[model samples]
Target: MPATVFSCRWFALCALLLLGGCQPDQPAPPLDQQLYIWQRQWRPAHEQALSASRADFSTLRVLALQAQPKAGWSRARVDLAQLKADGRPVIAVIRLDGQLPALDLDRARAQISQLLADWRAGGVMPTGVEIDHDSGSARLSGYTDFLIKLRGLLPPSLKLSITALPAWLDSPQLPALLQAVDSSVLQVHAVSNPRLGLFNPGQPRDWAERWGRVSDKAFYLALPAYGIAVLPDDGGAPVVESEVALNRGGERRELLADPQQLATLARQLRAKPPAHLAGLIWFRLPLPGDRRAWSLSTLSAVARGEALASQWQVQLSARDGLYDIRLDNLGNLDRPLPARVELNAEQCDGVDGLSGYTLRQTPKQLIFTRQSSARIAAGGQRALGWARCTRIDQGAWNVYP
Candidate 1:
């Protein structure tokens, strides 16, 4: 070959190598979908949700399914066969109580070993094990020690993961602790203050950015799919209630979230994810009849980047001298439907079946509005109230936004 031609080829090769070396390595594709089953009892709704078209979860993180600390060792009850039949990889989660930090290392190791043995015996071996602990910053050292010991006990084939708190990232020991595990799940949701709202809009972005800069370990972000009630305390300050309270004949109040917020968060994460971020893990898998949670269709739509729209319908019916006003939500998103139905007082004498709703008498129309939380689920309907009419005129009834 000519000297000039040979020299040019060599230069081109070197340029290619330098460019490849300078370019950042692409991160591995994240887990497309994941969910945590915190409830012990497996309701039919759970099965239905799992089978639903929208629930295309690739992994199921089952909590407290097989193991719990008892006596000196751990007690386990895992149904490996059933889990295997679920047609997805299972990540068995073992919840540690406050007693974890106080337990003897040797005893803790033995209990964990026993738990694994129980799982193996039941043929329900997990693809990975996740330690769910909300260890405080002060307990970082202890938590790190526990993880290191746990890693030593875990089989080389099984991945060891943990549910990490944002607070842990602030600790200097975080990087070292992360090194001890194969992967970690950063719970970006539930960090919101009840006094503020069920969720903080900026939390996901803030945590992801912080985690990207500090940690080099692979991790997933856990987001919320459920609602929380913010009740007023004795001092009138807002406090988070344990759960949404409901009764057959009692007042009810709730603070429900719009799932679109989660979609917005997902978009932000996808647009700017941390270098080590793996994917998202929903705080829970919502099931049918879970009025307080997003429906499967809504979640799927959000995941697909589809906009959620509202659809409402109202109907009036009468039998004898009594009349009924019903409101329905036909949209994919759950919304607070119109709680008040207006009717001409000349046609309707009085209203009933609205125990928790208040009635207002205007000059021409009667307005019945809900006094508490009155949200309707997608495709769900509820009676606004019934009216006693001097003459039932269904055409005169109307619903307000």
Candidate 2:
């Protein structure tokens, strides 16, 4: 062969080796420096959570008067009224510390009637009423009787809601007790303190499933805002803290609402949606003066809604413009808002000839629309979808598509 042609062939061979095709496409550049925005920032990861509510009032049942001292009933009533005035439907639980003044059934009837009348006249009839009797009282008979009579006396318009003993799910009397009320609530506190009945061991999901079997109607799962300290089994009363305390393991531990656990509940509900999964209720309203209060608020937000936006991914061929995304359902339960979708280049290599891209749903199969542009690069992933959903606690529309 001629020297000139041979030299040309050798040069072309060298060019092919220099390109990554010689080395198995260079393993797609080893995915150098990737970014991830988890489902927390995305939409519809969990449906059971309530939506982010701008208005303070939410439709889910709320338990009020839990944090007030026993002596503060009258004051607590007024405070609770204010919450009602704010348009939030509340569950007014009169805390019964096992003290009844001389079996005044007649006076009690009058008081109950007048209270209901006044609340109704003010257009603030509670969603329901409850008695917090967790003291393992043998006097439950009297309390139960009072509620039975009260339910009979009150008009059917008002709902009767109650919290049961930790053992109530298995209590033989629970069926009769449930018969008197519109709905029942099971408080799921970690029994670090066995003093307050057997800490219903097992997961909230399991408890919810079991509770579903006990009641044919909707019910609420009660989650405490604090953690309880289990004392030595000398029959000492257990201590409950709203904040994290140091464990004997010397670990800085706090018992607050765990979002991941909440998410797990959400996932379970999504997977199996209990027949009796009425809703979730957080114990003690307005949050006590503790840092866990923030956790409560965050959990409330998660219950309501959450949204996520992916980092601006680059598609060299993507055109620079707004891309319309048609999601399968538009996430009606999420309540997302209108937002800007901008075009951004790869922070590292702006010269990759505009790699291919698209604007699609998170779970691609859930999308209902196609890309507005032929090739969507940076602008596609930034496109926004509006999603709306009803929150379990706060019945407000949560937007997060």
Candidate 3:
């Protein structure tokens, strides 16, 4: 070959290599492995749990702690060092107050920039930044403009994403908003009152199909890994509250998706996801001792389409001739266990702990029957009603499914 031809070939090859090097790393091809870390504190237990479940997760979206806006934005506490050491792609999340003044965009931007700078100075580099805002449709234009400006300010190498509302999915500015970010997380779980249900399989499926038809940008469907408590108002209206209140009092119902239900949903989405639907991002990364939320094992089991096992334990106490039996569900999945409880005690007359349940004296035992709409929650317990017995001992009790 001529010297000029050989030189041209070498130059082309060098150019190709340079281009390839300059290209941003294509994100790990949308995996079934992503979780959101909303907790402000990163405990050793959290680290251990993450380490154990590390193989199941490819990305960790950590929330950048922020307090109520007074005059300017203030950084909240975050485990930046731990997050960096986790050895996974991290997405720093800035949860903007939904009620933030629209006029304070510039100030907010400056505060966010400072946060980014601090993250960099601290040696914590995130592959992306996610803006979590619940702005309404009317605020779409402002939100979109803010995102545009944010994109301009963000480093070109880093991607930008947002947690999108289902309401905004139908807005005309949605496409423009999506265009401003490299990817978005469409949360399809909390469409209705969580009190009604944590998630309805059909709602997410329908929304995913609809969203898939609309935009072609990369996205993930945020699913619930947590449970919520729904208390009835004086007027019988369902009011959703945090799980903490469930222990306080009142007739509140705890809502959570069954593991089987979640597994089925996962299978459905995996089999037929939207063109842009990347994968599922669980609402939370479960830590050890997080009773209100599904554990890492449960999440893994659901992802693998496996059934969750139920463990039940009963504790008996006696006071004032009344035997109190507490039935606790020590399982991961919220499921109905055998409500018919049989006690090996004679002359057991009346019972009082659970409402809508009846105790009948059989020839050999006392059988407690559960009424309709009665179910046990995982890691939760219900009183089996006090039984009027002559003596309370470690009597053999059997719970029938």
Candidate 4:
């Protein structure tokens, strides 16, 4: 395999890491475990916690099954039971299809019943179910009916979740489907057509705009675990690989996300997070010996939620009648010192515009040189921030002090 050259900004690397990586045999955490470390670089923390709590190490889920089920219902049953005993949450992803599977309803029910029994007996029920289906105009009545039936059959204690495509933004069936499942995870990675590179990634932004309109309680933000290599003329399946970056010396290397990007994601979740945004989950695991692989170290740091709070604390003191964005420690906030602050009046205070002023520590705020007109008016301030945010969405600016 040829080494990948690092091209985009740090954020782009993080996004790609979530999209295209493919790996096998990474351990799965048990369902009973409190933390589900998706990225492998985080193993140390898991080990640390295991030692401290004396908690039994559990199973970690693997996306082994294709979108379609090839084996018989009995085979699936056996797999489900084994995964249950292993203690990891079993996420059986079924791609969307208008036609039912080869198994009859009776067989499906029997297998499901057995799986549930085994899970309960082993004290390892799934955290929830995950369904990855594309959105289309063909009226998903048949699929919806199946889901409704599945919900009725499952133990009420368990949750039913589905992965949604960007097209859900326009489809009429979404409302009904959202009503059917316990939670819906929007695949924010490839919301647009992969062939033309027509991705606007407006899906997350659209969610933010309508957060107030929707009432779906828990939603997951499903980013890509690997990057798609688009071909000219005709669209083809994207080649999935582990994370890799090339240094100035031109050597292929694994690129791990800096603490800044991780913390930014956490803040996004905290601000306009998906309603009931439980936690972030990195897509598919990395391959063994892949240089750019995301490791357990990154996962552990993110899970602890210290990736952000530990760095860049602000102590507000009025300086020259303007709020100065100070730093307790110069972590990622590197530019210069004693930076002046100012906001762009024209673009400030809106969802779409890159609102608010950012200051560089090079002894001055370079971006806005003139004046600071950014003000919080009482009446308009109610909806200005994420006071009404109830869904996952794009952020207008980085929440930095």
The best candidate by TM-score is: 1
**Candidate 2, lDDT over the whole model:** 0.44
Candidate 4 yields a Cα-based lDDT of 0.42
What tens digits encode model 3's per-residue C-alpha lDDT throughout 123-164? 787888888888888899988988898788778998999998
Number of the predicted model whose lDDT against the real structure is largest: 3
Q: What are the runs in model 3 whose C-alpha is more than 4 Å off?
A: 1-30, 67-76, 232-239, 243-250, 307-397
Per-residue lDDT over 1-401 for candidate 4, one digit per residue giving the tens place of the 0 to 100 score: 32344444556878777665743444432112232223423333333333332233232433322223443333222233434434445554433332434324455556556655665576655666565555354646555776788888777877777766655556666678778988766655555545434223334545634432464566655533233333232245542233333222322222223334544554555555444454445553433332233333333434445443223233333333333322233321211122232322221221221233332222211232212222221111111111111121121222233
lDDT of 1 by residue, 80-107 (tens): 5556556777787877764543636676
Instruction: Write the residue-wise lDDT of candidate 2 on 265-353 in tens digits.
Output: 55456455556665655543322233333223444444544431123221222223222222111211211122222222122211111
Deviation from truth (RMSD, Å), model 4: 23.9
Clashes of each: 1, 31, 5, 34
Estimate every model's Cα lDDT from 0 to 1: 0.70, 0.44, 0.74, 0.42
